[model samples]
Target: MFAEADWVVKLVMIGLIVASIVSWTVFVAKTLELRKATLLANQVRQDADALRSLAEAGDKPALAGSAMVQGANAELLLSADALHDPEGVKERVASRFDRHEAQVARTMTRGVNVLATIGATAPFVGLFGTVWGIMNSFIGIAEKQTTNLAVVAPGIAEALLATALGLVAAIPAVVIYNHFARQIAAHRAVVADTAAALLRVVSRDLSRGTIAAARG
Candidate 1:
């Protein structure tokens, strides 16, 4: 079928195929990343002891990928600064947690835009090829001066093939893009909830002056 396709149609099919491949690649990668992030957020929420252990270790880079851990660690650092007012420390730590939550959401959503672009444009690109192919088919008919089935069938079949390929590439892209969008949103909500838990821990430690003593 590809061998029979016009050069322009062939290029369109190839481009759409490539786009479909890239969209699937992005979907798989993002799915894995979001799963890991969600797991990390859950761990932080479920195990206060482990969260404190991470902060006490002062190994900021060890679990840098976990937004909850990052926020907890930042709160520890802020609490350790003796010169800063207690109220000011809480504000700074809260700000840092917000930043980490935003970063986690952004990281989890990376590469998803490519899927969106492919889903939106692949059909139109295929339509362009179909139109081009049909135009050429009509030209062939005029030149051969025949309305014979053998002469018209092959050309019409080739033109329809572009539309088929276009839908093949587009439908999955659209479905996957929407699925990832919803998944990412849910993951972000989890991250935000974990950050809120960390903030509560920070508040309790500040009230007891435990954070400063731990720093000492």
Candidate 2:
């Protein structure tokens, strides 16, 4: 059917096939990225939660990709002059966590817009191809002056092929985009929890009145 499709229809089918491939590629990459980030979040959250104080946690070496411990320790060193006020330090630390979390969310969602575009536009693009093909078929019927089923059927079948290809591309992209939305949301929550756990340790350290701070 595709082999007999009009040039315009063929182009649409090719583009949709490419779009579907791209969407799946993004799905695989984003899934792996989010999984790794969540794993690191969990690891750091557990480590931060076990800390007796930020000071004790500070003595430990930084985990390679985990940001909570490193960023928290950096904030402490930056605001060491104001460590006398736990409220002030906590406020700054909290703000830092918010910014970091936002950045992580942005990174995780990098390729998601491609999926959104494919989902929204693929059907319409395919419709255009089908419409063009049908118009040509009608023109051919006028020239040939025949209403025979065998003559009419091939054109219609080939035109509808474009719509089928469009749906093939669009449906899975919509599904993947939705799945990623939920996964990314859950990953973000895990990050927030990790930050909160570290913040609690910082509070404990500040309450202890330890003027000594660790540098990242």
Which number leads on TM-score?
2
* Span of 10 residues, lowest total lDDT, candidate 2: 57-66
Indicate which candidate wins on lDDT. 2
Candidate 1 C-alpha error for residue 10, in Å:
0.4
**Candidate 1 C-alpha lDDT tens digits along 38-106:** 776666555643455334434434344555555656566755755246677667777887887788767
For candidate 1, what's the RMSD? 3.2
Q: Once superposed on the true structure, which residue ranges of model 1 sit more than 4 Å away at CA?
A: 48-72, 75-84
Off by over 4 Å in 2: 58-65, 211-216
Instruction: Kindly list the per-residue Cα lDDT of model 2 for residues 1-216, writing each as its tens digit.
Output: 888877888899999999999999998898888888788777777776777776566455544345666677778888878877889989988998999999989988899988999999999998998898788778778878987777677778877888998999999999999999999898898888878888887787778776374332
- Cα shift from native, residue 213, model 2 (Å): 5.6
Candidate 1 CA-lDDT value: 0.74
Clashes of 1: 0
Compared with the true structure, the alpha-carbon lDDT of candidate 2 equals 0.82
| lDDT of candidate 1 at residue 15, scale 0 to 100 | 91
lDDT of each: 0.74, 0.82
Each prediction's number of clashing residue pairs: 0, 0
